[model samples]
Target chain A: MKTHLQNGQVIDDSVPQGDNEAVAGKVVSGSVIHIQNLRKEYASVAGVVPVLHGLNMEVMPGEFVAIMGASGSGKSTLMNILGCLDIATSGSYFLKGRDVTALDRDSLAHLRNDLIGFVFQGFNLLPRASLLDNVALPLVYSKVSREERVVRASDMLSKVGLAKYRDSRPNQISGGQQQRVAIARALVNRPKLLLADEPTGNLDSHTSHEIMNLFKELNERDGITIVLITHEVEVAAYAHRLVRLADGHIVYDGSSHIPQGDNEGTMSKNSTESSAAAHSTS
Target chain B: MISAMLNEAWNSMWANRLRTILTMLGMVIGVSAVIVMQAVGQGAQQQVRESIESMGSNLLMVLSGSSTSGGGVRFGAGGIPTLTIGDAESIGELPLIAGAAPTVNETAQVIYGARNWSTQITGTAPSYFTVRNWDIAEGAPFTDSDLRSVTRVSILGKTVVDNLFGDENPVGKTIRIKNSPYIVLGVLSAKGQSLMGRDQDDVILIPITTAQRKLASSQVVGSVRFIMVQVRSAEVMSKAEQSIVDLLRQRHRIREGANNDFTVSNLTAMANTAAETTAVMSLMLGIIASISLLVGGIGIMNIMLVSVTERTREIGIRMAIGARGRDIMLQFLLEAIIISIFGCLIGVILGIGGALAANGVTGIRVEITLSSILLAFTVAAAVGVFFGWYPARQAARLRPIDALRFQ
Candidate 1:
């Protein structure tokens, strides 16, 4: 039996009754998010075509998962729903034991503020403002006092190695430097879940690897949940687990054995979905 | 929030310093015109009042004709022929009238030494100084004895003294009036020019008996030019005028309700007319100046709209960062108002300079009233508020996602 939480996500309240219980049940916890039978579709002149089809996923309290898919494989669609940027058409989504699928846009925004931090591919910085101002923007919306917001934003920028550029405009910096500032801005509000969609898309491969390393350090040290979306298999390899989607369905979900510290190699030749499944069982 | 808004406004203004300065030019010129025009108008009114006061209130000038050569009826010609030495004597009997004098004037040439000067000669009784509000600055005026004896004695005005005597004293000296010798009794005080630009102190005054006996042609005491009446106080002048007009009209056998050949204008009426004309002119100038203020406001609006377009991406980023629409609106609106208010402040300084320039160019006393300055500033602020609102609203209503994608 599934019970609906106030956030509109369904909680699977049934306790396991041995091996048979692991078959179809998706367990949702008191401090985590769970998704089951999640579907999203777009109604175009070509009729209703599904973007996400009967997908199932779970996020633990401190799990760092990366999603890998091609451009049209529905990875971003799933990330948007997970980050509360959009709502799923038919799904049971649970966040911290509360159902969140039925909440309105305002409530969803509230939840995103309280629970999610998003880093976009474009590093959406206000071009004319200082880096400190960009980092303090979210806190400004949350009604933080001016003095406190400045102090916090400065500290966050310094931690992200952007302290020297705190007063500089976005146009005065390189792409990697801008992305570092974006990362500092994302962390300023200290949200529980960091949803980064192609967070290093505009950076060089070396900068991308450095950014992934920073993400890994943040996840391990702060125990914050991290969900990264990327088409590059090498970028995804930095995560502890991988969810591969194809034709709007998760073709594989398992522990990924990436080259332990190979920052320069693409992990695409590591194995196929079938081989990964065989390796997981062995 | 207010600090952020101000920063936004101030920075935006400096973003295009040349455009902002150019826009302020319209307001500066407009405000200056209004202030200068008002000051000059006020100065003109004051000059008229001073001229009237200098002419004195006691003198009543009467002409025989009802109209000037220009075809407009002269104001005080109604009781002219009937107002003679007899009416003057009668008016002297009134309680409010302290004295009355009959006058006769003629234009003639007076030869002294080898120089010939064309002068206006006035004949009047010995009491002319008292009734006409004139004073002697040198020697003495013609006395009662001179009037009784029909003495050929005269008092010279400043212009006559300057021409006939130069630096020498003219008192007790002999001068020719129409080929007849007359003793110069005194030199009158210098009264400046009148509103018509004519010299008020140009003519010479002689005893009425001398003017009648020496300069008269072939007729009886034809007509006294005017009866100059003097009263105890300015407060009683109106009463004195009414009494004289009533006595003269009755003596001339004029009916009631007819347009009297003569008119009476008091100092108060003349002053009031001058003031009214000045007020009307200032009001018209103020309206014209207000048009420039409107144009300044339009300039602000146009610039603000352009600013909104240029900052769309910034606005989107702010919205994405959790700023509400109202917050964005306030930021832009505040900027526009700040720019306009700054313009107004500078315009006020320019307005003061304009008023001073007008005063220097034309010797007019322009008084800038506090209310006028305040009104101008209030209109400026209102222009800022009114025109700045639309562009601010446009910035605030932009969708976050669309704004960020504007590229």
Candidate 2:
């Protein structure tokens, strides 16, 4: 299947075109993420539970994409693989043209630090650290000098308009402000890709829009590639393209403006019934 | 990276002030216990060593053998008058022997004008001072002429001088012993206490001839109680002892395979045994204190494990933000080390203070050596690393997904 971008670019999943160097499993040069035949599984007492089955996708540089899925749809698993937080059981996943599956644990960590930034749903700031230190946390692992780390982290904090609260801890701020701090931290290292997993899940609708607007501004103004995960249609509406997952498969992959009632109806119905079943069994 | 981790560790510890201090309490108690116990034990050992040195080096005591009475009742060693001034003189001439003094001691009442005290009176030649390493603090010791002329001259110990003279200089003053007036020749310096806990300074010395003729007139002439012999050095102590034994046996005309009339005892050997016992006691105290250090280490491990579990979410967040396993491990490990080292610092201060207080209150000698402080620090640091390893590894080995999922 071919997924077309708003900027007149096409992501062909079948065969990558020119600049695809086949030197020892190297892929097309310009794609930020290129995954082919990706699969993941967990071994349980009963049997093997497969979460992703030979999923193929590509994300070009500077594109904003949102992944939407019901509960148990394996979207979280795919996001984890893209973020380099987990290794696929069997797959050829190249992040920034380097085969991620072939890298060791430390090398993968370096790649994540250099290439991708993560914003979790919980706005996971180190509660004990000041906001400046929280934003500077990634640079600590990146071997940045202390002076430079503070400079860069404060610059990012000011960009997110939380400059005055640099010395404030996470608990001292409101929920929207905390998410803004999380965004500041995510952008501090100048990573090429921002992988936000349900970044606004904990906020009310008004605050969620504020955080979503911050993500949109970071994507458009700084040209940072963003792949956000969420089940909320309004949150996904900000992204130019959408990938919807159902039962470990991408049921719809197209423009985000497609009527949500038809797509979300089956997804939300499946989630509600499954949740009801889970509740009754428990 | 290390500095940043240290800062992070410090912040976390500061955030959990109560828990950090509670964790450090174990190490503090352990290190202080080690220091105080070592001080006390080393102080005891030093006291034993000083007492040993004060008795004179390489000394041997030759005591007269026990005597069997009419009904086969045996008197103990040194009960008979077999060791005499003649035997002591002959022993002094031996090649390995440094000097020998025939000594006879008895309790007697000493009287000065308006003051009188009962004290031990030792009768011996002037060589007794050199043989026993007794120094004269003031005036001059009596000479050989005094011994030969049977002069009624005496040397007073510090304790005796304090009692009889008060503030007066006893030298050239007359003191009455058994109603006979004797001129005080000199005063001996202070010798604190003997190994047997006897007051070495509470004595008076008189000429052996004067003592034999005037004081103990009922005894045989030239007979003495025991002979104090000094060897040249520690190396020839056994040789000198054997030579004295053989010479005494031959002099007393004891037959082959028969016990001699006198027994030679090595004082150095007895001192060595006492020193060894104290050394063993010191070592035992150190070991006992080290057990508390072991408990402290275990306490660190226990608290670290709990910390790792509690901070799993933080570890997950750090890992998500590109922290490697080693980074997480180092963070936790640094926290443990900081706690222990700070605890050690406080413990050293408290231990030294406690040792000084013990010395002040109990009047015990306490030594707080630099080596012991260094030892406590190193052990505390080593304990921190050793116990922190497993919990740190447990935190590091956590999967990012699993850790993030931990509540």
Candidate 3:
């Protein structure tokens, strides 16, 4: 029998017994990410404009969650905070059960290198580096030996089906191939969590589905936790769970199996409402 | 990790080969200029030091003072023949004076076989050789007995030997000076030049008694142009000079407050002044060349700044992949160091080549020292690090989010 807390509220309570032991300062929950009352603000010429207003979320290990939101929903900010690329204004955030808010800049960088991987929509590969070198980039920051880095990077490249093009530059490959290389680089470090921001935003429908299938396969086969951000219903449908944001607040958190027509109509209306809210605040 | 960053820097530099070379050009020119200028200036100083050494150490020249004639025409020092052989002999007996030689010189025509050349003839005792640190190359020098007997025997300078005797040994041969025949005694080992750029090995030596009797009959008895004095050591040079001046004044019976009839000049002090002047000149040359190195360092900073700005997106990508701020800084800094070191290497080669060429073309002395090469290398590296740091810091300070959003 255990007790659980969610969003500062006791959500689960088993039968109270005198023999039950208290965990005492240990987070017993097996969550990959835990955020409580996270807030972020930006100072503009007008005044302090608040972005995220006390958001709370939790992601369990091996969970495949898709975050969906319009442009002004603060979803990008949340993703940055999760990736350790940005910090929250207030409240505590934990990754892999370590307090991220207390870590310095360099420590955060090391955490990102050790525990998380990021994939961007731009397919940001070093223009002059070969695919093999690009995949080996994260291991360089980890102080891995040269021979081992080459071996692991080549192995990851082959897993992405880019073994034949290991020496090819990014410009020499197609957009789909480039995205695959980026994915290979992100996974070369074997991070516990993968954060992808619109991994298919620049791809066509067929390529988008191909990338999403690769993600799904990695999650199911390796039990790798994934937190991706997207607006398309089809992309979200590939994930096991979905989280939606509107006006800096969570609008939905449920299974990804929402009806297609209904989900599309709600997405459009939420986008419009968020845009209006953005105008009024500015 | 450092090797990986180095490899990345190499690739980026290779990708922009033209720009890299252009940026390196400034360093090349600056380093080479510094090397060449230092070589030239040091060469000049060395030449001056060598000439000063040839003039001998702890030496003094006592010149006869000016004399006013009836028409108020004043003759310069060394014109009145006030110093004499007796004065030189007395000065030689002083406690601090090592030796003194009375010398009289005049240009005269000399003939050996059919070859005749006009050359300077110096008449002095054999002790002049000891005072001047001169050595005889062949045969034997004239002795005190020869001076007493007033024998017309001469020691020939190398230049006089070359001109009058050609390849033949002039020893035990007769040479005519002003129609008076004199036997050749020996030849002098060559001393290249004096501090005044006068050829040292272009004069002939004879006994002072012989010059007074046979060459110039109009001069007063026992009188010579000047007296050459050598002190026992450098420490007592001033004391010796003061003693000599007082002794000469007492010997001449000069009245109180009256000017002496001779001037004693410390040749060593004059030589030191010349050496100091050249040292200052060398330092000035080095400083002027260092200004170019400063400009070259500025050029490196300018190019590094432009490179950082141009590669903002690439920096963002590296940061996203888990590169720390220091990692980014080191990468750019390494690139700058590589450029400067390579440039310095090429510049060293070119500078040595240029210095050799200048020496060959102009026949001027040029010295290239190991220390100078090391100095140029160290300074170039320091310049690279100093100039590269700011641009690297600017790149490091960039936020990953902002850099990623940059176009």
Candidate 4:
């Protein structure tokens, strides 16, 4: 029998357990997200191609979740849905105890603006605006007063160790510093969920380690739930929980405290259908 | 919120200063053209009005014949000698007649102190000066006794005095006209030029009785060139003109529909025609100049499209920050408005400066009215809203995902 992990407990894979009750029963309050049977498809010239097939996931407040998959494993599509940038084909998504699937585009945008902060792989800062202005951008949509916006933005920049460079533009800073600014911008609105897609994708390994450490620190001290997508094991090593997707289904969802060498073996065995994931990670 | 949008718009424009300036130039030139055209038109009309006003508003001229030239071979209104002094005296007796002058214009060579000059010599009663809105600058005008006695007294115009007497006063001096010595009575004030381009001050005034009896013997004794009549009141001018025409036709024994032997032209009618024509011409020029503003608006639209495409990534960034479509639209719309308002301000300065320069350089009259400036500015703002909406809409419609992925 396959030994699968649920809520940090080893269970038999033959049990056919419903994961929603297991996660919801564990954390009664502060349940940030609850999704069941989430399916996503794209209309291709050939036909409708499914990317996520009946995916079920649950994330409690303040938990750092790292989602790992190779290029065709639908990791980016999953991040898009979780960030409210997209909708699923047919599924129920309750974010912060509100039915997100029933919301319209504008309401979804409002929810995204209010409850989620997005960090892209590219550190997409408006090139012409100063770091202070960039960090205050989300508050502009929220109609925050100028004095409050500046104060809150400056406070976030100080947390990222970029307070001195608030007046400087994005291009004037280094790549690592730009990502730090992006992080500051993400946290300026005090979003409950921080969604970062390969936040350190363009950085060197040393800088990526520094950035991931910052994520861990923020998750621990501030109790901010973070979900990051990455294809690199080293980048994913920072998260407490690891969820691996293969062929549009979750192959493994467990604590990532297992040895690194053991992960290579499990990847090769579990994602045999997608040899790309095993080879890319190894 | 608006302040935030404005600040963003200002920063984006500052990023491409040269392109912004180039775009502004189109509207500047457009608005300036409109103002200059309107100024010149208004100035020309004002000049026409001043000239017409100097001719005495209620005055009427009784020419010897109709204005239409027979068979299209044009003849001056004074070509026929059909009017007589009797016609003038009868017109003067009417209830509406304030005064009458039978004027005869003939060029004469005058000599004074070996300096001789040829100028127009007008012979009429003293009322001619009043009817023509002329004030005597030196000695008094010749009286009716001077007209009946066929006296050799003459009133010299300012130009004639300047040329003939230089700085000296010629009131008591003698000037020779056709070798007949005449005493200078008064010097007329400068009247500049008439609407017909005739020099009003380059002439002399003498009695009509003397002109008929002394200068040209071939001219009949009873006939005069034309009759200048000033109506007692403006309200009675049309009635005055009608009664005079009827009396003239009766004296000349003309039957009904038999084309009267004379024409009566009133100053108000002539002034209205000239003023209307000038106003219409100005409106036409104003309309033509405004077309350039439309072209400027198109220029704004074209440049904004390029800006929208160039800043696709920025649009995506803003959208990701939870900006609604209207927010993106407002940013661009504000940008276009700033350009338009800036363009209008510069154009107004240039337009007023150009009008003044035109007055100095080309000597063309140009009036800069407050209303035209306001009108031009309002139109420029409207142009901003009109041309700006499309490009702003295009930006607003962009999907955040697609825009971020754009290179």
Candidate 5:
């Protein structure tokens, strides 16, 4: 497979899946993210249920991708494993050239502390703390001094356009503003990977667009690698690349119709469904 | 990081003002109760010591027994006159005996100039001053010559002088006791209340011979009411007492297996008994006060458990933000300690105020010692740590996913 890099999108003729996918060109991008045959299971009362069945996917540096799936698609499980909130039951998962599957809980915490920034769906913030303090929460775990943590947290809050509301608590602000504070907190540590598990899951459609626009600006300007998980197609429409999952496996991995201005592989049911969709659209 | 944790803990406390104050109220009541109760015990102990000290030096009283016997029936301890002046003189010669005085007291009407007062007239030798560790403020005590020659001379106590001779020097004055003219030789120094709550300075001192000759109506010439003995050394006080008993037994012809004819009472034994009683009283008070502290500690535990349950989502958010298990534990623990420390401060102020109030209202001494305050403070802090542990551990051990999922 060979990839041609446009200004802000990765358009590869052959999509990469796992470490063995041979990619020619700068699409490899220093092998920043590599996952091979990753699997996760949950022991429900009925029996041991496999959530992610030998899923394989890879992400290059500075790419803004969205993983879209319906309920029970295991997209959330894959996002958890990739964010180091959980470990894969089998196979290796790597980020920035380090195998995260073998790391202990403390080491994984350290990785999450310095490397990954997570934004949750509920805008999970300490309700009693000010916006600035909420943003500075993640930096408290770092070696940064108090003054620097404050300064950097303020800077991130400003970036999220909530600088004026820095002194207000989460309950005092609007839902969109609180979500912005959550985003500021996620970015305060200057992490390498920004992971959002439904960042606009609770916001109105217009406010969700505003949040998605902010994510787009952050990706374009800062070149920060981002992987967002959402079930909504309109929310996923803002990403440069789209990877769809179904029954714990990748059904489609290609550039979204927005960047490439192509309808190809947009909502492919399967490989056969992609052919059928191409014919039907023609 | 620790300061950050404290900051968060402080914020949580302020957010729930009523709960925080209620928790602290328990500690305040507990710590202050312990302190005030201990202060009362300490004050009581000081009063006991002072009361024992007012009696005299390490003294032993040998009172004549069988004085209460009537019709061949002995009633009580002081039933008969077993001590005599000759026995006192012999006991004085013993190496263990520092001093001995044969004392006989009688109530008499004293007249000086135009004023007259009824008072006690105690007859003894000059060695009575040494035995009771008394000093003459103006003139001399009646001497052995005055005792042997039966001189009609007297030394008035400060209280007797004040009563009979109002501000006038009673030394070398003439006072008639029971219509007998006796010259006042000197005025004795002032002594405070005795252990029996009588004024020690309310009597006149005169020669034993004079009293045996003129004043008291008695058939026995050499027999005295009691003998006051001072030990040469405090270490051999018991030895001195045993030797005096042996001498008295042989002198009175008290047979073996017979009851003692006299009662020997030492200040050391009296003081020890009073101290034991006070200690038992203090222990009982402390146990009762500590029950309040136990209830207070339980109150802390109950509230802390509620706080942990209420803040489960907060704990999850903190953990997701990179807080370790230790950090969560420290946050809750710090919150509890801060509450206890503030409560301790208020309790110390309240306890000291209570002690002062007790002193002011009841006119009873209430000594608030620093050691008791320190002990109460330490116990309060320990209560915080002890009662806070289980809830804090529960907070730390919570799984982040489950906590976040909880409503």
Candidate 6:
């Protein structure tokens, strides 16, 4: 698909769905937002320095993208803006293809709650609450009925393969299991965007891979859009595409070299491997 | 959301268990102090009331000789001389007067078979028993005939009986009193101890006529020393006292400006005084006890502040997870209240137990008034809210990004 930028310059890309339809020179194809000329500045004793400098971004519906960066690369600031935890100092940001840069605090909070599911690096599970209760927390905040919340929370837990451990405290579970619980908690309200900030940063290599695999599974199986921030290349490999940021702007956006064995590919690969095993036995 | 906030608070409190407990300690002491002090105070008051009741509530004590200038009889040092047997006779004539008894008292050391008891000896009218609410546990009082004939006979108090007769009944036996043999007439009933720590039943009672004729031998009984009178009912006591005071004042010819020599004390007034005094004491005690509750509240405040600091990271996490400032604030605040209420519950149990134990040891009555318990619980809950607010606010105001970023 070819779309013209604001400068009437032609840009070519494959449109995934109707979410990428053009609107005032900005792509809007079921994509809720198009970030253009986004900028963030921090004032210290030294003076104002920008953290996000004219950053261009697009979030399409049902697309899992990872933003990877080295330390102090302003990925966190970008994630904050995306999650509405903080507002960008100056930006042309459209949410659901509608401008949300002018929204008030209450509106922003409502938007964050309605659309965003944040999974932190530390899991951020309330240590004293049972897994089901933790998962049911967002529904509680939204004033969902007790019975409905319980049913939904249980379903979410079962989806994460933690149905049996629903009554256990977060501390009683393994680190990977806790992250899975956090994922369940985040997804309970069925938020439109899963915003995970270095979700596997605190885990070991094997657990980190397991978490990444689970994220990939959730993105593929449930079709939930995920925007993950990470420093690790291995962690970013599970996503369909990786966007690398340096300083305050995107330096790279492409598929990583590593092939993530998704469900359909795994099934086909498994069939081939099993045939090879059968032939060898014969 | 409220419940989630509560859960957040509970978790934080549980995480810092020691600090939380220390915080609750101030409240515990404050609650216990208020409760226990009031209890002890009530108990002591009850004890005094009971003692006064046992002393006969409507009885009036009348002493002779006024301290006025123009009295014919000089009552030895600063004494009242208005009261006399003739005045007792007039008081007895009143319909409201139930009984009247004239008395002459002397402290004596009596010896019997190698045992000695130092006690008061009283020469009294036959109506003394009725007037003083005294019953003869064994034997009888001297009759009117015994009094008219000047017969030497005596009845002993319990202490005197125990000292002189042991377990044996000494009625109809002859006992020596002041080198004169007087027949044992009766033993007075047990009246416990007096307010001044004197044994109430330690005295000996004899016929007033016989005491005057046989021992002191003067028609003028020194200064009309003592009289114990009882009214027909407690309601008529004030009227009876006023009437007697009026009669004595007229007979003594005291001027209006002069301080009356004789002091007439009704047991009812004495009882009221005692009760009032005890109530004041209990109030002081209650105030002191409340100090512990204050201390416990401070403890809770201290722990809550520490908790606010300790859970800064967790608070940040919740704020990031779509929690508002109010949510975080309420969570910690709820935790603070819960701890105080817990301490209050425990302290109430301890206070009641302590008060009951004190009552047991002191033989005093303790009434755990509902108001006291309710007041304690309210104060404790208030302490929680008051002390917890600052910390909760601090937690709520914490920026989510900042908190999560806290190492």
Instruction: Note the chain A TM-score of all models in turn.
Output: 0.84, 0.85, 0.85, 0.87, 0.85, 0.81
Q: lDDT tens digits, residues B193-297, model 4? A: 677767788999999999988986566776888999999888898999999989998999988867766888897788778889999999998888899888888
The residue-by-residue lDDT of candidate 1 on B1-407, one tens digit each, is 56655765666667778987876666666566666665666566666766667666645443443442233444445334545666667877888877878778788888777777888888888678876567899988887778678899988989888787788888888999888898888998887767566887988898877777787553246457666666767777677778867877787677876545544445445545665876687678778878878888888789889888988987766665556677788888897777777778888788888888767887567877777677777888788889999999998878655676677
Error of 1 at B72 (Å): 18
List, for all models, the DockQ compared with the true complex. Answer: 0.24, 0.71, 0.65, 0.56, 0.45, 0.29
Q: How would you order the candidates by DockQ, starting with the best?
A: 2, 3, 4, 5, 6, 1
**lDDT per residue as tens, model 5, B1-407:** 88887899889999999999999999899888888888888887777676666555778888888433236557465455667889899889888988889988889999998999989999888889988878889988888989889999998888899989998988888999999999998988887666555888899999987887688696377678888888888799999999988998899998887777887778667776887788788777777777787778888888889999999988877777677677788889888889888988998899888878888999766778899999889988898888888789899888766676679
How well does candidate 6 match the true structure in TM-score terms?
0.73
TM-score of each: 0.70, 0.92, 0.92, 0.87, 0.84, 0.73
Model 6 chain B weakest lDDT span, ten residues long = B73-82
- Residue B43 lDDT (model 1): 61
Q: Assign candidate 5 its CAPRI class.
A: acceptable
Clash count list over all predictions: 11, 0, 0, 0, 6, 32
lDDT by residue for model 4 over A146-171, one digit each (tens)? 99999999999999999999999999
* Candidates 1 and 6, the one with greater DockQ: 6
Candidate 6 docking category?
acceptable
Model 5 CA deviation exceeding 4 Å by range: A1-33, A44-47, A258-282, B66-72, B105-222
Better candidate number, 2 or 4, judged by TM-score? 2
Stretch of 10 with least lDDT, candidate 1 chain B: B62-71
| Residue-wise C-alpha lDDT for candidate 1, range A1-282, written one tens digit per residue | 222211212222232223223523545464466776788998899999888887766677777887877768788888877866567889677776667898764466566656777788899887767889888877866778889989999999988898988889989998888888888887888887888989988889999988999899999998878888987777877887767776676665655444333442545555654334323432
Recovered share of real interface contacts in candidate 2 = 0.69
lDDT digits (tens) for residues A40-159 of candidate 5: 899899999987777656777788988877778788889878877677889778788787988865677678878888888999999999999999998887757899989999999989
lDDT of 4 at B317: 76
- Residue B153 lDDT in model 5? 96
Query: Which ten residues in a row are the worst by lDDT in model 4 chain A?
Result: A1-10
Better of 1 and 5 by DockQ: 5
Docking verdict class for candidate 4 = medium
